[model samples]
Target: MEADKYVVVMNSEEQYSLWPADRAVPAGWAVQTEPNNKEDCLDYINRHWTDMTPASLRKG
Candidate 1:
């Protein structure tokens, strides 16, 4: 089969909530961004995940 292509951070689309960097992303995964709207919580990640990422981060 082909590889996965994205990661979904929530059980459902409704849970795309974003907490503060310290509270949300573990330690090193923090990327600064300003939320213009509610959609920022749901990040569209690439499929090329590596060990550098937190285990909690999904692989699609």
Candidate 2:
């Protein structure tokens, strides 16, 4: 069996999530990376999203 493809998506609050490459992205979210295998997509998120706090809650 082949592995499923996924893409990294981000919302206005700076939250990142994985979405199926074959499906449409949900509202209020934008694609952040190209379609790739699930593992790679996860790695990308791990490397990039260091902070868990939302943009609105982060202090300057």
Candidate 3:
């Protein structure tokens, strides 16, 4: 069996998501880190994406 390729994505809102590495990324979102397997992608997001608020809404 072949493993699936996954990439970590971030939005203007600072939200993190896992997407397929081969597919086209959606507008308003960009790749935040290198691609990895599903587990790695999830782990990275869990550790890094501590805040769920958008950049504009977060209090400084």
Candidate 4:
């Protein structure tokens, strides 16, 4: 990881800090959400996350 590769997966509206396995944690943390709706969930992450995940990579 060449820095800026930390991502956190969570489902709430709170913040926490963990030792990132790769890059430095962002302003707070990467907030992944499971919202009531699919778009809502995607929008939540899109709003708070950096577009660093490569478009061609498989997320799983």
Candidate lDDT (C-alpha), each: 0.34, 0.92, 0.88, 0.41
Query: What would the per-residue lDDT of candidate 2 be over residues 1-60, giving only the tens digit for each residue?
Result: 543899999998889999999889999999999999999999999998899999889964
Name the runs in model 4 displaced over 4 angstroms. Answer: 1-35, 51-60
- Alpha-carbon deviation at 8 in model 4, angstroms: 9.4
Could you arrange the candidates by lDDT from highest to lowest? 2, 3, 4, 1
Please provide, for model 1 over 4-54, each residue's C-alpha lDDT reduced to its tens digit, 9 standing for 90 to 100.
222233222222224443334434334334432323334432222223444
TM-score for candidate 4, residues paired by index: 0.29
User: Candidate 2, after superposition: displacement of residue 40 in Å?
Assistant: 0.4
Summed backbone clashes in each candidate are: 2, 0, 0, 0
What is the Å distance of residue 54 in model 2 from its true position?
0.5
Per residue, candidate 4 scores C-alpha lDDT tens digits across 24-49 of: 44553454532234444445556654
Question: Of the candidates shown, which would achieve the greatest TM-score relative to the real structure?
Answer: 2
Model 2 lDDT, full chain set: 0.92
lDDT of 3 by residue, 1-60 (tens): 444898999987888899899889999899987878999999999999997777788855
Pairs that clash in candidate 3: none
- Residue 26 in model 4: lDDT: 55
Better of 2 and 4 by lDDT: 2
Off by over 4 Å in 2: 1-3
